[model samples]
Target: MDADKMSDLHEEGKNAINAPMLPIGTDIHPEDTLLEENAERIMLDPTSRENLKFKDLLKVLIDWINSELEEERIIVKDLEEDCYDGQVLQKLFEKLSGRKLNVAEVTQSEIGQKQKLQTVLEAVNELLRPHGWTIEWSVDSIHSKNLVAIVYLLVALAMHFQAPIRLPEHVSVQVVVVKKREGILQTALVTKELTSTTEMMLGRFERDAFDTLLDHAPDKLNVVKTSLITFVNKHLNKLNLEVTELESQFADGVYLVLLMGLLEDYFVPLYNFFLTPENFEQKVHNVAFAFELMQDGGLKKPKARPEDVVNLNLKSTLRVLYNLFTNYKNSE
Candidate 1:
């Protein structure tokens, strides 16, 4: 091979070697993670702990939100419990899910509807505060079809994109959209087969706000939004990074590290819940739901090759993510 190709190979080998395998079920803490050491990276805390138990911690917190939603639903007329349609919200609760919260905000305001909002904000802020994250939510009247609640993730702690190729600053993911129309209130979480599938094979539609957070990714040109495939391809082109190369970089790379860190942190409280047989059964249920839809003429039979599996894996990952909170039987 040419010298240039050889040089590329060497670098790839180095990244592969240096990539960190962050353990699952680790909490995000300022002292526990690279958030302290590297002002430049939104780093991972690699310390492992034993004897962690879930005991339905996630189910409880989720129940709180679900109860709130159930109460509100009687009142957003536009909001429907459509499993395959409606807008997909960002992974706020997932990233925030399964954590311990201080209920101090529960007492902040005793006034009517404001009290419920305060309860959620206080509960979330308390949990995130220690990790250098300040959570904020607002009532959005014009951003969507209904009056919505928008959650903003502010970086209070020193965090960076994953190392090896770290982003200069951390990206704040906007999450947890609550919509109310007429008198009814509902959560917008599900992605659909028709509108949500952006590319025939790439990614799904998250919000354009996510693009603004990434430095190298383009400023979404038109106010008009596009599909996930379009978004991923456009950003990937600008960054000049192939999905395979980025995938191989894994937890060490900037985007994947931050993304995975958030995911793992989100899973901390639900650790045991995942180990439960019900989780897999739910996944299988989700798969069967998906398979039933595939009976349509749109999807072709996939070639059952290892490479094909890889491609399918990428899409499936994105698809699952799109469905993560929205399709959860509990979060409903």
Candidate 2:
């Protein structure tokens, strides 16, 4: 063969030997292709392979790249698994349903009252059933020649609490709605106040402390607010409380406290905290005070045996705190 043809054949041989198991997509850079091709050619040549030094060097490079790719795959698999998990699926369902159910905020022109309400209810029902929550809906009233409607939802909260032996009480959720003349709807949700344990733990904190933690929180305000409100709504009926302005503040406080605790327990030990020592203490104090407030209010008081509290893993609040802190530290 001519020189040029021989060179082309040699290149193709190298490409076949060094090509990744996965084909390169159209988006791959031309420069990367050239570099990879050159490296592969040098590694695959018969004379180069016989040279002990070159073979060892090529082996090391190949191993490093394979290791990195494997690690990335593992991480992606873990995240996918988490998204599929029941708890994660439920949270996503809540967020989507909550948005759809905001009757006052959603315009009739966008989605008719009935359609929006139906969608929200369906989403909630779908999620709840898998998590052992049975949902029941009832029409409260019909008005304007039955063109307008009102409905109520009762959700049975049956998730296993910290101790498998002692299950959480079944709670009821009530949602009220009034259809307007223009086919728009106004809605309100009511649930019982939190349990005595929750109230004691959450009520002890001064509102300002809760606000401070929220102000410094790492996540977006909307995200934090939504999560807090959802959590409160979930347990409100069990607690036997009406939703009020103070309840909003209390929910915010609970979220802030939980986020702070999460930060201390999970992220503080990470090497990243060393870079932000000054902020760490302030964050920790805010979390601890929040916990103290809850403890004082009798919200977080342990009902089971003293040791059960530790075993119960009632540290969800703490987990939130840690996630917030870690997210901020990582961002910095």
Candidate 3:
């Protein structure tokens, strides 16, 4: 072959190979490069970068959510290990999510159990402060557990009172017993049988007189009993003799004086005598004389009225008296 022809063939072969092989950084044409550069510049601009940052933030948030789900799995495992049953776990989950559980949809047993557990926990917290006691309450059923807890607390308080603390006279402590019914709470200082009478008698007395009555020490049982007896008898006698006449005749001051006199003279000493029941009548007469003399000596005037002398409920009155007497006997 001629040299020029051979060289031409070689050049053709080289062109064929080189045509398929692109140079580094020259695969794109100049116009295409310019278009790409424009596209890149648009994408790299401030607004575009901000959009990219937002997209990245959203991805990060998604990842964080996934992580939280994983963490919840671990927490659930721990809860299971801790013996948190399904109902309790569900409640805890709802609480963590800031949502309310569909209690109505839940089984009655589960709802009851949860409520009972909550009540027991509250009771424990309440008793912990004053009694310095710790309780570990666990239950297969919440209602029974809670009822037991309430009974336990009452019994504990009763036991605490058996060895009563000597509180100062000025710092009076009123012992109010509480009972719960249908999720509602009720309180009474004494039994239900005595409640009406106690309330009636307490209401009839002035606030100061009522407070004075409450302040009497436990040592004055006889005085309290006698006073109550006399007060009841006086009202009964007055009611029986001339109910209509006395109702119209007595003034408020006269009623107050009569009540106060009965309390101070008959009640106070009677309470003292009752504390030592062996000398009950002697103490009653002696205190009655002192009371009369004090009134006659101008220390106190008759302040109660006939109108103030209302008829007492005999049944309620006797019931309260019985309670007082029973309490006295129990103390001895």
Candidate 4:
């Protein structure tokens, strides 16, 4: 564990776990005499503290899920027990009264999982309330943008450079995320990294940048839209997920993990374009470079040593991307 506190001493300030505790002198000490209304003061690393809280919340949720699964097993057992000699019992009940006893039955439901998650999210929000960060859960707001943004990015930069107008069928149904916020949005690069946003001024910057790009590529903008439609359709065919494009049906952490992993796998450079304004043009060039290197077969050989895809083999990169997304889907 990282040191939560430091004290100037001859030896050292031990971590929070090993902090000095008063010696036990009595069966019931003053500290344990009654409920102490006063809050305890302690040092903490902000990043570690947040991470622990997130883990704690998630652990509780996982435990609850396990309990639910156990309850499901119990339900199945009860069903079996109740149905043991079911025909004999049915006859007995039928003979006992004109109206037969109504059998109590229960079946497992996915709704329980959704309710558990909602309750868990609320608990997480409560835990975060003390902190400045406000947790926000949106269904498909950012999820829809995962791969579709690639086409927009390609179109945005295509005005000045040659970007592939046609991507493979696999590009059609990219893994979409169920975007949530533990804090607030910045450049959207580091999700939930910014906790002190009083307003969405940065969001305006995002809009302006997108508007500027679209304005610059007025003629190709509509073509880009058409291309995005085709791309999304192809992506749907590519992925095995049952969810639709705009549906926020899946509100799960798997989506978040997969989305982050996909961005890391597919093209980190493309994501970096929105992160740095000063280096935006170069980043765009770098993004366009990889797509340019890609051909009908897969990622093509680099044109020159300076090429972005020069050192990276196209086939390996695509395989890793496909495999990672596939694994995430299978995990679900």
The global Cα lDDT (0 to 1) of model 4 is: 0.29
Report lDDT (CA) for all predictions.
Answer: 0.28, 0.33, 0.34, 0.29
lDDT of 3 at 246: 22
Clashing pairs in 4: 172-234, 172-235, 173-234, 173-235, 173-236
Better of 3 and 4 by TM-score: 3
Tell me how far the alpha carbon of residue 288 in candidate 3 is from the true structure, in angstroms, after superposition.
Answer: 31
In TM-score terms, candidate 2 sits at 0.22
lDDT per residue for candidate 1 within 27-53, as digits (tens), equals: 334332222222221221222111121
How do the residues 1-332 of candidate 4 rate in per-residue lDDT, one tens digit apiece? Answer: 33443222312332222333322321222332222333221111233324543334333323322333352442222211222322222322233223343432322343433343333334433533464333333112112122122222222222112121211121111121222122211111112221112113123223332244444767764454344334333433334533332112112212222243243345334443233323434533543433333331253432222222222433222222333343333332
Per-residue alpha-carbon lDDT of candidate 3 for residues 213-282, written as tens digits (9 for 90 to 100): 4445445544555655554445435425222322222221233233334433434333322222234344
Given candidate 2, what's the lDDT at residue 152? 13
lDDT (Cα, 0-100) at 277 in candidate 4: 26
- Consecutive 10-residue window with the lowest summed lDDT within model 2: 143-152
lDDT of 2 by residue, 76-191 (tens): 22221232212222333343344333334333342344444444446666655675443433111111111111111211221112211122222222222222222222222223
Q: List the residue pairs that clash in candidate 1.
A: 41-159, 41-160, 42-159, 42-160, 75-183, 75-184, 76-184, 76-185
RMSD values for the candidates in order, in angstroms, are 28.0, 26.4, 32.3, 25.7
Decreasing lDDT order of the candidates: 3, 2, 4, 1
Question: Residue 196 of candidate 3: its Cα lDDT?
Answer: 26
RMSD of 3: 32.3
